[model samples]
Target: MAADHTPLTRRQALAALTGAVLMPLADPAAGSVRHERHFLFGSPVDVMLRHAPESPGDAALASVMRGLQHIHAQWNAWKPGELGRINQAFREGRSARVTPALLATIRSAARLERASAGLFNPGIGGAVRAWGFHDDVMRDGARPAAATLAAWRDAAPSLAQIEMRGDRVASRNPRLQLDFGAYAKGVAIDRALDEFAARGQGDALVNLGGNLGAMGATGWQIGIRDPFGEGLLASLATQGREAVVTSGSYERFRMLDGERCTHILDPSIAAPAQGLVSVTVLHRSAALADAAATALLVAGPLRWREVAQRMGVTQVLAVGPDGRGIASGALAARLQFASRDWRGRIATV
Candidate 1:
C-alpha cells in the first residue's frame, strides 16, 4: 500500500504479521543470515532474504537476485537492447512478439484499464515520461504545459489498442509506450513469492518497494500509515495473501504558486488530481489494487465511495482535503475512526 505522507512519494509498505513461521535450512558454515541486495529494475529494487541460524541462504538469495536481473534486462526501458527492440517494432509499424511474462503483465493492464473505464490507463507512459518520472528524470520547476498535455493525451492509447497473440504482443498505437510503473511492483512481488514457495520456504514475505505479498498459511499483518499522523492509522491482520496499494496526492508533486500538484495524473484531462489528498485500497491482486487506487484517486471525494462500492472494494480509506473524510463501510468495521465529530465520518450505501 502507499504511504500516508508528503514529500516521500514512493515509500514501500509491507504487511508483515507476528508468529509467522520462517524456517530456513540450517548450515554449518554460518549462523542465521539475512542477505540484503539492491539492484536497478524498472525502478530501484531493494530485496531482503533471511535464513535460519547457520543456513546457507546466500546462494539462494543470489539465485533470486539473478532472476530479478533477467526481469530488468527484458523490462528496463533504459537498456539499449530492450529499447531498440521496442523502437524497432514501432518503426516497422508491426506488432512485436512480447515475452509471455510481459504479455501477462499487459493483459492485466488491459483488464484494469477496462474495469476502471480508462481511469487507470497504462497508456500514460508518454505523459509519465513527459513529466520526467522515468529514469529518475525529475525536473526542477517542471510541469507539463497545457498544449504538451493535450498532445500527450491525444497520442496516448486505450488498452484496447494493445493486442496479445500467444506470447507475442503488439501495440496498435505506435505512440503507446507501455510503462508498468503502477503495477510492476505487484507483478515482481508475486514472482518473488512464487520463487520462495517453490523452495518450500514457509511464511515468507516479499515486499517490492511496498507492494507486498506472502506465501504459506500464515497471516501477515500490514500497517496502513496515518496520512496526517506519525504512526499507523490501522493494521490489517489477514489470513490470505492479497495486494495492497495506495494512491496519494502527497507522494510525488511540486509546489506551484503555493499549491501542491501530485504525480497521479488524470489521463482523460492530462492534469493533476485535485481535492481528496490520498486513497488506499486492499485487493486480492496487486495489479488490481494498484490500478483501482488510481481510479479512486481520479474519482475524487464526491463519487469515490459510490465507485468503490460498485467495484466490490470493501476496504477503502480516503483522506480528504479538509482533513475530514470517511472510510468504506467494510473498512470502518475493522478500524475505528479517530474523529468522532459528526462532520468527519459519513457512510452511504
Candidate 2:
C-alpha cells in the first residue's frame, strides 16, 4: 500500500502499539545525535544528524524543513499547489509551465513508470480520488462502481503520454491526473539529505514515514516493520548513502464490506493491488527505492523478482498474505531477524 497522505493521530497510536518505530540505534561515542520530527507530505518525518556541532546542525535541520515545505507546496496533489494547477491545465487541454525541479521529477517518474511496465503509475490521480484515497481520512464504504472502474480502464492513463517541451508539459491523455504520493516522500528525503550535505552535515538520516535514507561513516541500524503483525520483522545496518523503503498493505487502507482495501492501485485492473502484504527495497536512490517497492508489491510474490530485476533493484524483501517472507540473497545476507524461526525463503536475484 501507499503511505498515508497525512499524519493520522490514530495511525500513530497504532504504530506505537504495534512497535513500528523507525529509530537510529543509540551510540554516544558516535557523536551527539540531533533529532527532529515534523509532518510533511502527509506523513511524519524524522531527521537525525550525528557528529555535528549544535549550531550548524540546527541550521541544517531548519534548512531541510524549509526545503521539505517547499516540495510539499509544489507537489501536493490534494491541496491547491502547483500540481493542482497543472492538473487543472490538463483538464483544460492546455500546457502548464513547470519549475525545473518538478520537470525533473516528472521526467524521472515517467521513466520509472515505463521501466516498471506501468505498474508504478503517477497518472492515476483520477482513480485515486474516485476511490476516496485523496481524502485525509479514508472512510469505510463500498468500492467504486463497475462503470467507474470501466471508464478508468478505458482511459488507461499513463505518464508516458505526458509530453514535455522545455518547461511546459502537456498530456496526450486528458484523463491523466498526476499523483506522486508514492514517489514524493522519497524525493523529499533525498533532497533533505542533499541539504545536509551542502551544510557539511553528511552524517545524517531522513526518515519520512517508512521511506528513509541515511549517510554516515558510523552507519545506522534500521528496523523493518512487520507487515503481518506487531513489532519488527527484521533489522539492517547501513552506511554511506542508502535508502530503504517499504510498501505495505497495512499502511493505508479502508474497510469495505468487512474486507480491507489498500490504497495502492494496480494500473492494469484500476483496482487495489493484492497478493503481497509488503515489499522493501534497498537502493542508493531513495526516489527509486520508494517507487521500486511499490512496483514490486504490485508485482506480487510470484512476479516480484522479475520486476525487481527489471528495475535494477537486487536487494529486496517481500512478504505475502500468508505471512511468509521472501528475500533476495543480497538483502537476506544483511537482514537480522527478530526470531530464529521466522518463516521466509531466500531467492537469488
- Judged by lDDT, which candidate is best? 2
Deviation in angstroms for 300 in model 2?
0.8
lDDT of each: 0.59, 0.82
Per-residue lDDT of 1-349 in model 2, one digit per residue for the tens?
A: 1111222233332433322334444445777788888877777778889888989989999999898889888898889989999999888899999999999999999999988989999998999988888998989998889899899889999988888999899986778999999999889888888889989998999888768899998888777776766666666778689999989888889887778899999989988999998898999899999999999999987788888888899899888887777778778777766544452332333
Compared with the true structure, the alpha-carbon lDDT of candidate 2 equals 0.82
- Estimate the overall C-alpha local distance difference test score of candidate 1: 0.59
User: How many pairs of residues collide in each model?
Assistant: 11, 2
Runs of candidate 2 exceeding 4 Å displacement: 1-22, 343-349
**What TM-score goes with each of the models?**
0.76, 0.92
Model 1 lDDT per residue over 188-228, tens place: 76677667556655445555544555543545545555555
Report residue 29 deviation for candidate 2 (angstroms): 4.4
- Tell me, by TM-score, which candidate is best: 2
Q: Output the lDDT of residue 322, model 2.
A: 72
* Stretch of 10 with least lDDT, candidate 2: 1-10
